[model samples]
Target: MAKGERPKDSRRLSRKKTKQKIFFDEVCRMTKLVPKNKLTTYGAIARAMGVDNYSRHVGFALGKVKASDGVPWWRVINSSGRISFRPKDRVGEGTRAKPFTSLQSIKLAGEGHTFTEAGAIVGWTKKLHDFNR
Candidate 1:
């Protein structure tokens, strides 16, 4: 699919047994559908994929994507509308020496997404793209 193109029929993922690679691919596809200046929660993607408990897994799959893959991984945030650290970032949630000024924040800011002084995206719910469309 072209960049940002939603899967023809994957508004929600199938629950039937599938390979882990397929699950990862589905996550990538769903993520591609998020608009440029919009956002979505990891949990929202998991729920849309029929696995509400898999938000962390969603984060993992997104983390594995390369920049060339056309997945806007920065458009995803935690349910609280805050940018989160990946396990590999070596920074625990509360241990960031600085506020949310990571590269991801810069990217989101470049796209017109606003954030709080502490780094939480402002008007997050209004910017969310639910993929059902």
Candidate 2:
């Protein structure tokens, strides 16, 4: 308990928050790389960030960004090519019973993409944008 010393738990929490902020920033940077008519998955971004299991973390970070940030958050989706929405944990907005906001869908469509009734992107495999390439 020196004047400049932090508690062990406090130190760890500080480091964790720093790492989370760095990860969130990286996620936004990568999301910006996706072009129109293309898409990337959560796991794909996690992999690019050098973490194999950060898919949820990727989604969580994007959920925190406001649309005015112009980071193209809608360009990222699930690994299976389906749009995630509602359930709060899914797309960062809406409830489990409420339909997801059309903002994402509308933005995506304006970029020349289509979705099935089930919210799965049509011909998604071809639209997959690979960062490694």
Give the Cα lDDT of each candidate.
Answer: 0.83, 0.84
**Candidate 1 lDDT, tens digit per residue, 1-133?**
9999988766544433346679889999999889898899999999999999999999988889888998889899998999887554432245456532366877888999887876689899999997778
In terms of TM-score, the best-performing candidate is 2
Can you tell me which runs of candidate 2 are displaced by over 4 Å? 1-8, 86-101
Candidate 2 lDDT by residue in tens digits, 62-91? 889876878988888898897776344344
lDDT of prediction 2: 0.84
| Regions more than 4 Å wrong, model 1 | 1-18, 87-100
